[model samples]
Target: MNFLPITKQEMLERGIEQPDFVYVIGDAYVDHPSFGPAIISRLLESRGYSVCMLPQPDWKRKESVQEFGEPRLGFLVSAGNMDSMVNHYTVGKKRRRTDAYSPGGISGLRPDRAAVVYSNLIRQTYKKTPIILGGIEASLRRMAHYDYWSDQVRASVLMDSGGDLISYGMGEHSVLAIAEALAAGIPVNEITYIPGTVYRTKEMDSVYQGVCLPDYQEICRSKEAYARSVALQYENTDPVTGKTLIESYGTKGCIVQNPPAAPLTIQEMDDIYDLPYMRTYHPSYEKMGKIPAIEEIKFSLTSNRGCFGGCSFCALTFHQGRQVQVRSHASILREAENCRRDPEFKGYIHDVGGPTADFRHPSCEKQLSKGVCTNRQCLFPKPCGNLKADHEDYLQLLRKLRELPGIKKVFIRSGIRFDYVTADKDPRFLEEVAMYHVSGQLRVAPEHVSKPVLDAMGKPGHEVYLSFLKQFQTANRKAGKKQYAVPYFMSSHPGCTMKDAVKLAEYVRDLGFMPEQVQDFYPTPATISTCMYYTGLDPRTMKKIYVPRDPREKEMQRALIQYRDPKNYELVKKALELAGRRDLIGYGPKCLIKPGKGEQVSPGMQKKSRKKTIRNVHKKKGR
Candidate 1:
């Protein structure tokens, strides 16, 4: 069977041979290896199960199910990166823009496009197949998350999808456990004791309980909290048994499990790079001259896992851990060689990075021998004095890749921690990195401009990001290169009010950059900010303050950063007016929103009207 695309025809062809286990449904990007579904499949296969990876089957179509043959056991796993709740908005409303590109059709709604397509097909082809649902898309949405898409709190994926169980968090261990028990003839309803698994009660009245109550009051009580706290809170609860193994107050109970600690040795990391990848679209799509999105075109190579940079909005440190684990240099070089053989080789290596590209090896050499280091760099906002601060080894690896025969240019497309770059003892190393590794634009995530917000987000001060930008500019001028730093900014993050967003907009305007793109904070399940958003207090330090939970207010605050757009004038105006800051309007480059003179219409309002007209025109044409 075709492992990548499980088309209907292939399912019919496989009908003659019944597999020992079948992964019923869900989504997966063809490129992600470390993703949940892929990892679960690998683990089950290791246990001697003849598993079939049915990625993103068309669950909406009945014909799609008739293709896949019946199996001994059915498994349903989602694309691990996303939460299924996102689907309810995307699918239920038939919101085209959100649903078309979604991993799961319309966040967490029944007949989820992907699940419905696959489940319908299975029911038509095979009767009474036991289906299981797992992954971030299924896991976080396993409980009600404030669904911005639908603007309402919805039930967990188990309730919505009608799946046997909803497994949350890093699922390697839980998936293996479930497959083993099923293979041993255990009933699905009796397997609620497992960690990271969520199932309904026998009567379907409430979720079951296996573990003790988590300290929700403590964890969710704080106004400003870390992402780790939120993730830990959910992972700690076993929804099937309704027990909380990990304790914290104000936090919701969830089935929590740590990512396997058996760090992929450097050699293992290197070997993974050597695996073959499909670098181009299939022939059928290519013949029609259709190019895939950049995410689809780029060949992704993860040099390491986890991160020490505890950026609040980011879940990397929580999900992957702060300790850096690397693959061998030989393994990376092997992968580069393989890419050269592909027909689509363009001489440009997309990205060679992990959570933090400059951080190589663990923070300390003793971590491997000592079985985990308690270095405070991974925990607190303050930099550790004794922390290992060197990039010489990582720099050498980049140089070696440049020397390879097939590779023409290597770019560090993954984000670089500017503070780490400034901390490096070797000035020459920084010079070499700027000169050799950069493509046209180097992307650096400064996140926000306000000091309080940056601190709350667990990032270095604004000056550090500015210092690196200056140094990068100087280096580019000296080398006669035209490369520029692409500063990524986020608006409406925790602690960011209209004032903070305006400050960020001023900073952007002073830098003479009118950013066309900006990120509005997305509070996923198990994120610290999400709890703060819901509870109005930081979980770490029970401080209470106002959080902009209203979606419209958040969108308006985000719009302030793009003041140059006449289209945003009204949004900026409303945001500033609501915040009672009228002085910023009608003056300076930062002023995108023209202030209303007591009663006249604003430029932003006009733009909105125009947009509405265009949208109505399209509606009339049925385009």
Candidate 2:
């Protein structure tokens, strides 16, 4: 475990002993404090168990297990940053250029390496330690999934990793139950009755079924079904192994829907905000002056949860449920105060926003009845009329925070739903957000310029992004502020093709704004887009379309976004030629290639030609 504050030697030297019952091993971005594993670990600690948190353990190393010295390391918990399965898809089989895990070569020590290393280490040292794998990685991929890297479906991580149990979605209740049972000397296999857990049968040849929840099968059949359920349903089988899923039926798998945002009690918000955090830099006294990157910090407080925009590529509504869960304004203020007081405080707060920072509450008051309200435009394909739209309270909350004494600046870094911001009947909120909250660049995911791709991704439309861009620019100009909208575009999404990518590249070029940051669609387990990417269309809608499933093509399409870069010119050319979209050449000022020119050779060829030309020119000069 590579911990920041306390060195392994320091823990050993101080004679700090391992806890008696639990050992948690997982990935954590310090900023995401309310994320699954961290929240679950805190819940367990609150229950009075001896818990050891090994944050972001280096599971690739065999020696990483030494962090837990050996006090009967009862149970191992596995939940990495996002879904481990999704992380596997990005790197496990297909090579990714921007993949953080494997940048240069296909490193064999990934995907299952974390699970294998931890399980093998514990088995060798602890002999009979119980290991449980959960989180999106394990849950959605708990059964065999289409292994893009392997080009074949493989068994779920639970079966492949050889763990004792795999708990799926929001494991707070399930983990606590498991911990209580373990403390009482309950056998691991007997705890199969627990909901949101997946485990192999006693024979280790098959899976066993647990209590089934409602509408589970419907959600897994297709993206539309999952969307209809708002991703609160779970349905999937191992794509390769075809093994029968044996976990509790209808148990929303391990997708933990967040508590609703509306009607938030002040006390609950206080409890969440007041939680202790190491806010300051732990490395050195001198390094304390500099703030850590947004990626490096421990503990992030979610001001709200749940989204209504319902983009197809997103899983928030399904995971957190459409109902918004907001912490009280005062509670957020207290949390900020606590973070500032921490010895780790570097005088900076990462971000204070969620799903859509502007739309802070359920779109309608009908949320009190759990009835669908359809006031706002249905962001999803089948827009629900029951959806409400409100940003007033959220705006007030933002204003209150700016007045906080210790806070230097509060950032709305979480990607905002721009359509909602523009839809806000009140311009004051947008004005304040532009003037006070924005850190110069606001990230808005317009996703695509093509209407079909936008529709598939559940975005409003390309025009909406353009409209928002105009409004944002106008707002900035009115305020004498030069803030820009950093539109987040996705390549190779389910309904997107090479042509779509080129069109988007042209659109961005036309806007005279080239985004350095672009997101390649990563099909994680249970995301609607992931399902569509693999199966080609919504299984329920039966709408057929072209999907760029080939990893090479996906890469080329992604590179086309940076067409102006000389290095990426060939990639853009290849992408355009491959898509038969050469007509778009020189469409905008950013387009590097000239019209009617022969397709330039590869960079290698160009380099060789340049050398030959230079040598011949030198020879002529010598003569």
Candidate 3:
């Protein structure tokens, strides 16, 4: 129930002369399931490998990385749960001031591109110690990708980090395979055969029947080529049908990603979650007031993994893949009972789900063996005829947890696939959620209400959200609940124009909810929408797409979502006028803003006189 050694003295106390592996992470060492390195290390320790953790080593000094010295097996590098650049910067490309994963809620603990920095630091010290890359940062960048902060296509992270190999995806199986391979005295360079791993090689012969992606040079020279390459990479993510993919990095080298490993079975998944997790940030971080990232998951349980919702902006398809896997009810109940033992337990279980809360299996039985379709999604456009929409199992799981002793409330805080919920004929699931699960407001991601934008984003049309909203309201009404649906909307997504923004504004207006926040489509690595944002070509169809790239336009798109806000009045007015829909500028139920008054001030924007804008002043006077 204690954490692995993070210092040489602790390792010596544990009677270890030299560790089998040194896990270098960009996050504070939290031995919880939510942290990737913790699971892999614990799982390896479970298999009898001595592991030590080096959390957020100072990349500026080689001495910091050599804290544990060279390990017998290798050095494992990860940039933590989130991509480092994403963690350190806002979508506006401004440096973030706080890092939740770091001790004391501080930023700047980990360098940007932390995996690459840490790995190279290891290379500087122990040149040939089988530097291995894993976790979200390495997983998403294992192949050629568009680096947002750099605003250019970059080569695989393994190349930059000097990592001998990379264990991609949820790497319980592949990471263990790597440890076993190294333990058997296999040369690090020759260990490219492991599925869920990426390795660079000179001989293509070693990669049997691998799909050759567009060469790095070609993909970089042409955006269309990069789009084509990304599409191919996504097509091969399915474990059932994926093949090894090889990308040439010039005449001297090639990076080969073996087919993704098959998902773990229920018992295997159960065992993984049941590992000896201390279930909190390492006690070393106690003085830092706890790692902020551990707060949500300290008592929350992850019931499943993998996402089939298939939002184009999401990177889950490349990382966790779409094959849903779950733990047994007994396993979950056992964990819930354990939660009750903690002195901090407050008669509630924060969450009991994973990437998608309701998914306990693949979308359909065929997906189990046939894999998710590469060209289309399971739920978008509309649910496929073969979609298994029943939530009976999930409902039963919820009911079982609800009945557990000392558990007063079991909430579903994770994303619930509303489309999946409405697709089911049974109303009992919705009724149950309305009655018990929602914490006053249920969060759902509609992303955007524009049809074309929704289509480009791999999300269902606006009507799907509307349908779910109506059903949710009816359910809450029947249950005598006053719950609300806080739909998440994204602005400035590819194919979303000012007109689309206006459409979304109209929809939000009718709903009488001016959202406090909106996500400007962040072009993170390895997402179809990111591809479109960069390449202006839909990877699925290669058709030309529109991207709201100009900062002002992106701002306007965001402002339109909250057009009712006095602060947003100027920006919304400008957006309406720019889109040639000036009719929306007048004071009418259909109008988004009032006509220009005394000072000809813009709506949805603040005036710079250090005083309230005309709209704000008008709003204050109860206009």
Residue pairs in candidate 3 whose N, alpha carbon or C atoms collide under 3 angstroms: 568-604, 569-603, 569-604, 570-602, 570-603, 570-604, 570-605, 571-604
Which lDDT tens digits does candidate 1 get at residues 424-476? Answer: 66666667766888767788888888987886677888888888887887788
Candidate 2 on 28-75: residue-level lDDT in tens? 323235455555555555676655555445665645665756644365
lDDT against the true structure, per candidate, is 0.59, 0.58, 0.89
Ten residues in sequence with the least summed lDDT for candidate 3: 601-610
lDDT of 3: 0.89
Q: Which model, 2 or 3, shows the larger lDDT?
A: 3
Per-residue lDDT value at 439 in model 1: 67
Q: Is candidate 1 or candidate 3 better by TM-score?
A: 3
How many steric overlaps are in each model, in order? 61, 43, 8
* Among all candidates shown, the one with the greatest TM-score: 3
| 1-623: candidate 3 lDDT, tens digit per residue | 57899999999999999999999999999988878888899899999999999998888888998887889999999999999999999999999999999999999999999989998888887878899899999999999999889999999998888889889999998999999999999999878778899999998777789899999999999999999999999999999889889999887689999999889899999898889988888888888777988778888988899988888999998999999989999898888887898899998889989989999888989887788888778998899888999898899999999998888888889879888988999999999999999989999998988889999988887788889999999999999999999989999999998888888888888888788768888999999999999999999999999999999999999998888788888898789889888866655466678766764534443323224456678889999
Candidate 2 residue spans exceeding 4 A from truth:
1-18, 26-37, 55-73, 83-113, 124-128, 184-186, 192-196, 199-273, 280-300, 317-319, 342-348, 364-378, 574-582, 586-592, 596-623
TM-scores, one per candidate? 0.75, 0.74, 0.95
Q: Model 1: what TM-score?
A: 0.75
Higher-lDDT candidate of 1 and 2: 1
